[model samples]
Target: MSGANEEPDIPDLPAADPLPRSRWRMQLVWLVPIVAILIGGWLAVKAVMERGENITISFKTGEGLEAGKTRLKFKDVDIGVVETVMLAPDHKHVLAKAEVARDVAGLLVDNTRFWVVRPRISGGTVSGLGTLLSGSYVDVDVGNAAKARRDFVGLEEPPVFASDVPGREFILKSAGLGSLDVGSPVYFRRLQVGQIASYQLDPDGKGVTLKVFVNAPYDRFVKTDTRFWHASGFNMAFDSNGVRIETQSIVSVIVGGIAFESPPDSVEEADAAANTQFELYPTRTDAMKQHDRIIDKYVVNFADSVRGLVVGAPVDFRGIEIGRVTAIHTRFDAQRHSFSIPVEIEIYPERFTSRYQDGRTGGRISDDPRGIANYLVDNGFRFQLRNGNLLTGQLYLALDYFPDAARAKINWDKSPPELPAVPRTLQSLQDSVTRLLVKLNSIPFEGLGNDARTTLRTANALLSQLDTEVVPRAHDTLTSAQTMLDSANTALQPDSALQQSTADAMQELTRTAASLRTLADYLSRHPEALVRGKSGDKP
Candidate 1:
């Protein structure tokens, strides 16, 4: 009964309420909320798909850091954003949490460098001026490695060169870091081709090792025999060649720089590989010197003073440089009771290759070094100190043949070997002057002067004697001779009696000679008259 009552009531009520057919299309008012929900779903999906990695960067300080504000940029283009900045656990630095775009995943590799961008003046370069207007930002330099890392150490200073600056790296070892720094320029023929990337003391603490990057095209110019030197400031040298000064450029002088050059005369060699190690010479002269392969060290004992000789003084064969003086030492000879100067010379035997070509072929000059040494000594080869520059008083060593020099031999048994040395030309001259002075000192000049005075006195006395004695006698004798001559003149007078008597005697002698001449003629006419003679004459 209850069912019948409830059914009838329900059917009537349903029929009455037969509620108008529900519309198939939603209302315009509802469309607004539906569209908003759809848009919200689309945004959620997009965010999920485009989500980026969260990276942590440790910085020494967060001077200009601001969460949700700073951005990571590359080439002035934003690549990431800083989400948060907090103090590190150690409190020694600040940790920056950043969100980087997924597209730059390849850039987040090992060696990727990051630093803050702000107005900076460093190493003579002004950078990040735009950061002043746009506010500070995080800068990144993607590295060239395969490994990737999310945690990074932020750099305090900006990198010297970005990866976009195509170049090759090289290593240079120097005795000391003169004026070189990270931003110092590298010059190839005075053109800025690169810069010093970094520098550090050697592990041994004996020298400095510098990393340098040579820009692409210029890197090819570096050869296996390339030489590097400090081209900054003044490259001054004072020696036999006199004073010399050299500099790459005014900029280099102000900021310091490195210069590299390959010897023009050197053989064509392959380009140096990346990260090649080279020696950084103090000056270009030392860098350009030909490398000597064969060095023969020998000691030369000098009796003369080496006042002007220096360690780097060149040792020449005749006029050709073959070596240099490496060191000089003084020794006391107990046996001889004298101090001797021993000069240690470094001789590059290879320097004589062009001259003594026979040595190369192993002929009379054998490859055995002692053989050459013996031959040289036997042929009167000796070492002599020479004045290289008169103004600088620089002395060098000269090797030449001296046939008249005292005989000597090389003592090969001694360490470094021993060679004979002659006195320097100046020392020899000084010694000669000293000997002359000694001889002059030995000469009895006072005695000579006294003898000269006595001789003058004797000469005066002799002159006086001659004037008082011989001169008057000679005059008297001359007068007597004049009288005799006068008498002879009187006897010879034409009107004198002796003259008349002489004429009569001459007439009688003439008659006698005429009669004798006639008798001789009669005898010559008649040969029989010789015996019958003058029979008529005899009768």
Candidate 2:
């Protein structure tokens, strides 16, 4: 479609220079795609280089796991991803196949722990809250095994401690679990220093064995003789002193816990070895009770009602507790036709030796127990029921010297060596009061009262007669006496003639006394005055 009007150039146009040949032959527009290809190749090599190992984890459930969504994390750092979630051949477990980064290859060991982390609340701790927002992830705890592993069984729950956490574990054998759980705290002197790791019932099903882990410095406190006890609930006790409530901590009361202590005075062979076995006492009192080396069994036959006495009641020597009641039994006497209560007791003979320490009854009994018993019995050493707590009415067997006690003997033939016991002082007081009450009840009070009432009635009638009859005569006599008194009063008036006459008579009597005294004195002067009465010239 070219027009024919163009004229030919005079020089033939130099053959239309074919797009000038140059060293930079590529087009500017094509350069962009070539550079992009180079970058893409480098990225492909990087992806192959950074790829991680593939691992299969078996979980009890596939919850919170999703293919290509759930990530494998070490300390919350994404290291891999789950490629598939499926069931195992047995269909009992979920298998999560994942790929972890090559950098963490060393962590894929035989003992490595893996678990799915979601929002969990347990043992008073709330964890994995972040997972609620971001989603659950497969968390790994690096292991330190010499061999590597590709397949793993995820933990039913998270591991309580990291493998590198420094601590030791101990085994506690108990008759029962006693409100214990895996994460129950462990205490040393009321300070939380550890937790329960695991537990299993004994093969014989007679007890449970619990494993407890104590963190570093506290683990050193465990000793061969260390005592463990259930410090779960608040220990409440009421005694003669007062009510007492004791607990390791408020948390322990709610969650349950275990406590351990090496007696302050105890000597240990060494810090208990790892996995050392120990016994768990039911209470701190039992755990702290001193172990007795030697024990003696004896029975006391009491005549008084035991009332408040029970098994485990203290058996006291003077004021010191040397034994405890173990059993209480009753016996019927055939000939006497009476029932007697026999209390079986356990006496720690060590308490009687010099090695054992006590303020009262220290080394009072000899090592030769039989001979000592005989001698003590002869010297009025007797067992008697005594009131331990007056308000509680608790009775206890007491060994004391009763100087006036009746003679008695120990029946060694008895299996437990029967020791005679006397009634408590309260029982004696009760008996005396009963006898006095019986005597008072027998008194003829009604007859005596009737006689007294009859006598009172007779006296009342006599008094009535006096008031109606004899009283009038008495009043008449009183009136006559009153009239005479009035007359005498009138006659004895100060200005009356009778008073004047009385005064005159007193003056005459005085004058007569004076004359008599003068006469007497003159006679003394003159012995012949009587014969010469006319010679009194002083008149």
Candidate 3:
């Protein structure tokens, strides 16, 4: 019976030849993981593409830059990472391989500069790490300047600001540059508007070419008549009366700066003509024209004019500093017997014209040169000496204003007189001393020595009379007088025995004479009494 029931089991296996599975089952099994892997790979490829940029940077110092750890940023946003670092063949620089994200590609302009922005201190500002880290680099600025596509170099300092701000370029020539320095502020009426960008030697190497930047609105203030000067450092001074301008602070930041001085009365003219045509010159051009209409009526050689004037002397027109002598050099003039000296001078004609001009007046000297000429004529336009520093004998040219009557006639036919020149300051005193020695050589020292010898002889004779003849005679006379006084004192003594004896002898003589007179009276009748009385008296 159980076999009969179980018979169906064999039949059941054959009956279920049922629905056949699809042939694509094996393919489906293989496809799931493959699809997933493909998707994952595509995503990864996209990520890499988005995160990558190929770039190379050169560095002189690799102190803080690190491979794989360093990042490139655009406006504080991380855009790339340093992939590799290799030393250049010359070992002078390090080449940094970096990969930047594709999103930031457009921001890399032709002028884009890639510099390692590390922490630094400048102009009282602390940047980059903010004292948090030492060696980390921040993406610094590259000027929008066009450059070739190649490896970029990192700068040590980040630029303070964009350059080529619309303005005029002024050129200043100086011997020592005084207190002028780069990054010094430029002030207009004591308000800062610009700064010194950079400096270099002029092409001729005779002067310095300063690249100064003047910002926006203030740039317009610089005009054809604008005057620039150095305003820096301490200039403490005092007069003989003890009144002084003393500097008491050291931390003070009165740094070197530039200033503009314009004619006060021409304010309206300057404003109106501020938009006139102008040009940018890397160096100062001799564009200022002299009053050509006025002929060079008198051409006086510098040496002749200053022959008698010392270095610190005044070249005055009624005691005014029309100009200053910057330097003096000699060149032989074959045509003439003397050497022609070229004297470089600087003049400030502001005060001379400032008082006479008004807002409507154009900046022309010819308009009112009569006053200047008259002043010069009245003052004799002469040179006089002045002491820049008493101790150093440093001299400077000063302008002295004097009445016409006090003026001395200058002889143009004769050579200029040789004048004493002092140092301009203590530092230049050595130069004055050197020149003084040269002039001192011309003094008659031999004659002075002879005069000194004669004076010594007279002094010696007077001393000898006082010491030997006069002193000895006074001593002998005093001794003789002392001796006579001593003898008189002894004779006047009341207790002397000789004095008592003399008194007694006088009494005896008186008694004897009385007795002789009495005997004479008795012998009146006879003369025999006188002789007899004397003989009896002796017995």
The residue-by-residue lDDT of candidate 3 on 1-539, one tens digit each, is 78776744344344555798887666657789999999999999988766655878888877667888887876677888888888988999988888877776655555666667766655334567642554465473434555534356765555544533456555555434444556667667667777766566767877665656677788777765655555454444467877654221221145455555454533434431423333221111112222122222222234333343343243444555555464565768777777654444445444355433564232335555445545664564543345556576555555444344344443335333222222223324666787899899989999999999999999999999889998898899899988989877776677776677877999999999999898777777667655665435764
lDDT of candidate 2 vs native? 0.88
Top-TM-score structure, candidate number: 1
What's the ranking of the predictions by TM-score, best on top?
Answer: 1, 2, 3
Worst 10 residues of 3 by lDDT: 282-291
Whichever of 1 and 3 has more lDDT, that candidate is 1
Q: Candidate 1's residue-wise lDDT over 114-169, tens digit each? A: 99989986545678898778899999998989999999999887878997787889
Per-residue error for 8 in candidate 1, Å, reads: 14
Clashes of 1: 1
- Candidate 1 C-alpha error for residue 182, in Å: 3.1
**RMSD values, in order shown:** 6.8, 14.4, 19.9
Sliding window of 10 residues with minimal summed lDDT for model 1: 356-365
Misplaced by over 4 Å in model 2 are 1-61, 65-114, 138-154, 173-180, 199-209, 229-257, 280-286, 331-338, 354-367, 406-415, 431-539
Residue 493 lDDT, candidate 1, scale 0-100: 100
Candidate 1's TM-score reads 0.77
Off by over 4 Å in 1: 1-51, 83-95, 102-106, 121-124, 176-180, 189-191, 203-206, 233-250, 282-284, 355-366, 436-468, 482-521, 527-531
